[model samples]
Target: MSQETLFTKIINREIPADIVYEDELSLAFKDINPQAPFHVLIIPKKPIATINDIALDDRELVGHLYYVAKQLATEHGFSDEGYRVVMNCNENAGQTVFHIHLHMLAGKMLGWPPYTDNAKT
Candidate 1:
């Protein structure tokens, strides 16, 4: 069998996380290394390596992930103020964890393009 991803461990209760929201189909938790004042991760109970790996049959599960993110934004008092939901697809997109997850960031305005290095500009 393949090794369990860190998120899977959290889902199975093998590891602890600062979980904020959870349902039968999904889990939401604070990011260990947050990029914004309010950064959370929403993941599915069933492990899918990345967005590219999501199967057609998993549509409901994937859609529920977004719903959970939206609910969390409201619950955390940031929905109307504005927030961002991001999903990194692969290594090139900065997806350190293989599991499919959505990043919910808010609490402040985010930079545009997400890259500001003059050298890269």
Candidate 2:
């Protein structure tokens, strides 16, 4: 087992989160601070630090994360229209948490020009 991340705290029932879906390998939940109408954070059960921090052995798990995100998006009624999946890799990429996670956002027309100068602009 790896060191505990915030997601782990939520997974262990220690922290509070509006969870939408979960399985042995992953967990999906509403973002505490949402950027859109349907903003959910899908995370792995294992505590990998970031995208670059993921090991070769975690390749399948990474792919599965996207799969589960898509599954949950469909379940949440965002499959037909559209949705955005994001994984911030590092501090420069606006990653607040050190755990590897996928952000599934939809239910609104997202703006273009994804980010600006170390912040979402």
Candidate 3:
């Protein structure tokens, strides 16, 4: 068994988080370090480590994560205009937390290829 990650602790209620949404299989909360005007993280209650660790039986749960993200975006009043759901993979993808989670970003138009020096344009 892999070690319990930070997200696991949050899901277990061992730590406090600014929870926004929760269901039998998922949880959504505000990101401590906001990347956008409205930044929220939607994660499965199950500790699946990372996307690569997702099992075949977890397909539905993974789908539920996106569902929750969409629901939250609508609740946050941004679904109509637009929003972005992002999931970082491994270290190369800037995944500091190993747990599987989706970032729902909205409230403004986001730039493409976030973190670029604008040299590409």
Candidate 4:
């Protein structure tokens, strides 16, 4: 088994989460600290640290994750308005968790100029 990440902890049922969606391959849940009225986090069950860490063989999995994110947005009642999907790749990019996860932000106007001036562009 892979070393337990914070996400693994949540997956193992050790930690609590407001799960919005789940399947054999992935899981979606509300973020503990939300940035918007309808903020959620989508993550794969596999322990992929980041996008750069993914193997070519995992291409399908990667695509599936994004599709699931879209599905969750539709199911969660944000299909009409729209939402933003974000993935922080590394520490320099403000990635708080090592495990790869997608943040779904909606329910309000999303402004440009992110959390910090250090954004890569």
Q: Which regions in candidate 2 have their CA more than 4 angstroms from the true location?
A: none
Give per-residue CA lDDT, model 1, range 1-121, as digits (tens): 2358999999999999999988899999999888789999999999899888888999999999988988888888998999999888877777888889998999999988874543210
lDDT tens readout by residue for model 2, 52-116: 88999999999999999889877888899999998998787889888889989999998776665
Candidate 3 residues 1-121, lDDT tens each? 4678888999999999999999999999899988789998998888877889999999999999998988887788998999999988877777888888998889988988775542210
* Candidate 1 segments whose C-alpha is farther than 4 A from its true place: 1-3, 116-121
Q: Per-residue error at 112 for model 4, in Å? A: 0.8
Candidate with better lDDT, 3 vs 4 = 3
Instruction: Evaluate residue 46 in candidate 3 and report its C-alpha lDDT on the 0 to 100 scale.
Output: 83
**Alpha-carbon TM-score of each model against the true structure:** 0.91, 0.91, 0.92, 0.90
Candidate 4 CA-lDDT value: 0.84
Candidate 4 pairs with clashing backbones? none
lDDT of each structure?
0.86, 0.87, 0.86, 0.84
lDDT of 2: 0.87
Which scores better on TM-score, 1 or 4? 1
Candidate 2: pairs in clash: none
lDDT of predicted model 3: 0.86
Q: Give the residue spans of candidate 4 off by over 4 A.
A: 117-121
Runs off by more than 4 Å, candidate 3: 117-121
